[model samples]
Target: MSFLRQRKTTSQIPLYTGLQIQTSSSAVPIQIVYGANKIAPNVIWTGGFSYTTEKTKAGKGGGSISGYDYRCGFALGLCEGPINAVGGVWSGQSITYLWNLGLGLFYGSMPQTPWGYLTASFPGQDLAYGGLAYVATASFDLGSSPSLPSLSFDVHGLLVGTGLINSWDANPALVIQDLLTNPQYGVGFPAASIDSTTLLGGSGGSSYQAYCTAAHLALSPVLANQEAASSILSRWLQLTNTAAVWSGGKLKFITYGDAPLTQSGVSFIPNVTPIYDLADDDFVISDDADPVEVVRSDPFTAKNWVTLETLDRNNWYDATPVQVWDQNAIELYGLHMDSSITAHEICEPSIGRISAQLLLQRSLYVRNTYQFKLGFEYCLLEPMDLVAISDVGLGMNKFPVRIVSIEEDGSGILSLTAEDFTGGAATAAAYPVQAGSNTALDHGVSPSPVNQVIIFEPPPDLTNGVAEVWIAISGGLAPIYKLADGTTGES
Candidate 1:
């Protein structure tokens, strides 16, 4: 057999430039404005989404509550150029109108409505497309004499499908097909609408069933379309046991078993070709050695169930409740109550499962963390994306982790903070027990017989012929002892 050398592929970083700004409130299609020389090269954008379950007391008859929070923001520099009547920064009438609102200009004595839809995009990068953002704050900062005469704009708002500002009425039991295709209530993307073809993976059918069986899925009197969608999506996922991702102007319903998208040179894989060029001087990696807080919560035992309340077509209260618990989790991390209670409209078995999953997932975050700083090599990496990191010298080989946060500095360097997703449960299981470790000789033990003896094995590396032992009585103080010479110590 002929021997062949395995060749490694070089990581290529995509060059990203230009930001496209579009308006969605207008009837006519507005031209997408590209941020060229007018916009600063170092544009910073942040998007965050998370779902958490709050534990409740055992006898409260309450199940775990799952809630999601999503937000996005963008900060960029805009050059205030000379206003030409026809084609300058403030030229066209429409441009002037938007600029006036962005600048918070007052109409006569009253301030004009500053609410509008803004979509930012980067034409050079595949993953740089942004969702609709309600321009909540458009603050501008004028620099000092030494700095360039530029205007810095900070845009912050909820994602398009997350606000509760719109109101509409619909059938109580709307199917997924109708809800998504009706053009009024569902995803209204022209070129990026979701369909049955997209939901083939995972629990898409179950999610569809959940959506169809949902009672009074209509938007509330003061709910926005996006907010309504968020609620519906959350409930559907909870019931169907599926996951959906919104990116690049499209909504993709995915399952846990779906193959993760592998981006070359972006993910770290140990013993394999490096996806990133670590030898670059600008590349920096820092380890966060802080102990991860162990999050423990009581499982949704059979005694504790979820209450799903919904309004029927006649506006009557319809409640369905179920129990969702994982015996393994409960056995590992005793009964820790999560007291926060939140109401959900949809009542399905999947709700409890989703909540339990949330608890189990949260418990897995108790692991070491690492932060990476690369020079514009991984700008396309988004939040929630799984990446591999393998630094053999640092004892980190192809460690799979998820990106928790992404930040871009003024110099265009991208900084990412990631956590070990696979090591949390093990770390938590191996945590040292703190009970009976402290010495308090002044404390007196009650006149009760010590009936229970607890023994803790010493670490394998410690060859000393000694183990920790504790003696306890039902109503008396517990004492600790080292088994070597029977030395007694009060805990």
Candidate 2:
């Protein structure tokens, strides 16, 4: 027969539903995929198990089923290629034959399997897998391949392909021999040959090469020993390992300089501890003699700006005596006189001048351009504290007061001398001048008169010895006096 175009292996095969079909007693371990056509068609049973190995003629066929649902876990990777059209015939092909054409089962254990081997036979194979079983076979009718109705079974230790289980290989005790042997002959067959050229149809004639090349690649490989491969695999080649590292290929390390170091040349020391670490505060300042920066919002006021020194009267005769740059630094020390003034004995002043020295830091004089005010208050404390006798008289005046004079040379001293009336009767223990008896006679005194000649030193910074003057009378009434209209009169 000429080789004809054969369609891909049974694509419409329904999943095995674990429905058992009765078979002839002569069938060794059960034709799990058999039907009236004498050969079962190919079909897949997802979520089912099948045995990958079978027994020999000398022993009953048996082996553990290898699949996700099998007693022993096995993973099968079906290659993405066209499946074979030969089905239902139990082609009696070797494991390599089925594998070369992108069909086979991956056998392994759940936790682990120390050892395993593939098996096949013409008939009389035993079942060792414990789970639902499935069988796939093909029937070509009218030049088209249609898969046979699959055998549904709960048979333990059955065999299977990635997509389906072969019908003739469904015996409960089917061995490798039964799968490749003609059912009628109980002898070795060409399909069961272990010769690599005949089985995998490869020049190298190796089952490993055929199986490995034909198996579909896994997206991720479940490892038998994760730690071993993890240690061997290069990080760059590991698709699942996504960690990134810097130049040194080590974890990150960071150091910070928080404070000055103790070494003379070093500016800072690394703070080994983190910010939250309490012990990180061991750093010290760089130098012992370091200046601090101060920012002032407003200049100092009277409460804190300047400090005062003692006053000086020794330079009372000097022109530039109190060399004070700013008067704020010059303080006067004297008896705090009451706000009262009186004339005792008409001129009984303090016996001698009171004096004190002022010592100040030289900065006060060097920096000039400052001003200040010296303040004092004087008032009459007793009546008759003031007396005035004019050129006309000195109370009962007789002598004529011709001239009156006053002088102050900026020496802080004032000299006052007045000429009184010459035509006046003398009074007992008083000035001997009288135009009237012991009384202020208006007619006997001149309108403009000089009765008192008082001399004293003025306060600091005097000009022309001119100052405000006042006098109090018997009623303790004080009236300011000024030189006006050729006379010292009340203003």
Candidate 3:
């Protein structure tokens, strides 16, 4: 006996409403009504959804939901207002008008103070529940026809926990460790388990420990716990030469020297053969037609030089300048000041070097952005996930890229923005090689090997009847040095 196999049919799924708004003042959730009513046929809820993340610079995510509220003759009985009254209020039976007037549970003024959550979920999708969300703003349209009422909300991702309102003076790493291990901080998972890949232990572990001891963070009136953690983690990464990523429901602070993600390491691939077929209408591609490649002119410079200046606990000042310039860039565009950044929290020479390394790496600029849209059946990719794109026609043949952003339209389409993984390699190559003690300067300062030497005559005003020349060295430590009176010393 032979069994017959059934083929699955593909159909577009319509989005069903699964939104609930609960305020701190109310015990029950507010039921949002959609569509027209008998007395107010024009008043209808169009649609609204929010998009938020903790990955962005704002360190918070927010989105708005909007709909139409038109006033027609058939709805005038429901929209009639009091005459000759100051701040005249509407006594309409229209649901939109009622919502606009802050009537019922849809209190428009509730969000002015701290309110409750706006939870969302998809009925049939796995892991469809959204994080707790705070309603930031809600406004109703008051214009003529087809007015839209929108409610803007922010997701309670990493920054919704109790804030550190007091001043904290301690080792940056210890503070971070305390926050990561504390449940009140809302960073670590249950039982305060951080990912093992964290940089607290590694070949660079000793250096990280030194960084913890050397740098002191004085944080006063810090924001939410997540934000404070993010701030401290950011400083620690800069000082300890590492990176932090929130993945798998845990926070992991890894070093930049870690191996890149390969095809074997990715959770899953989307739009690939055997898994997905673009030829079979599985995905659509959109490339940036006029992508920027390089910086060719002024005001568009990279950080070739970084000066780290800090004061110790005893108020002793220490300044260390590191230069990592591209000779090709200088020959092509001349010397442009990339960054003269200052960090007061850095105290150790090793931390200063790490900070310099980070700044130097970021000085290498390259921009190439691409976007793709995949069907809902395809697995969703989060920001910073590594994936390979294979498009022969567009010269993206199995090229690995990092996801920059992801968006899901209500129509079951997932959109993603991916870019070339140029992770600090451009300027990494420009890092100066260590030199021997014999190459040290007469003033007991040993500078890195110079890549390019530039000499220029001083302007007449500053010379004061003396012949003066300015010397600029590129690609080594200390790109700019002043020498005077034929002395071979840096001034």
In candidate 3, which residue pairs get closer than 3 Å at backbone N, Cα or C atoms, i.e. clash?
Answer: 48-65
Q: Determine the backbone clash count of candidate 3.
A: 1
lDDT of 2 at 93: 28
Output the better candidate (1/3) by lDDT. 3
* lDDT, candidates in the order shown: 0.34, 0.22, 0.37
Task: Write down the worst ten-residue block by lDDT for model 2.
Answer: 347-356
What TM-score, over all chains together, does every model reach?
0.33, 0.12, 0.38
> Mind giving the per-residue lDDT tens digits that candidate 2 earns over 425-454?
110011121121123246975355344555
lDDT of 3 by residue, 1-491 (tens): 33676767644333323222221222222211111101111221222333222221333454322332332110111111111111112233111233344422221221222222222322222121122111121332233223323322111112111111111123343445554664433356453455543424322232222223222112211222124456656764664444566656766553333222111112111121122223313454347532212123232355455555532211122244434455666677667665455554443333345456555554544345667777677654556566666665565555656565677888877886765555444222222323212222378666566677889998888888688899987775544554666545532
Best by lDDT: 3
The candidates, ranked best first by TM-score, are 3, 1, 2
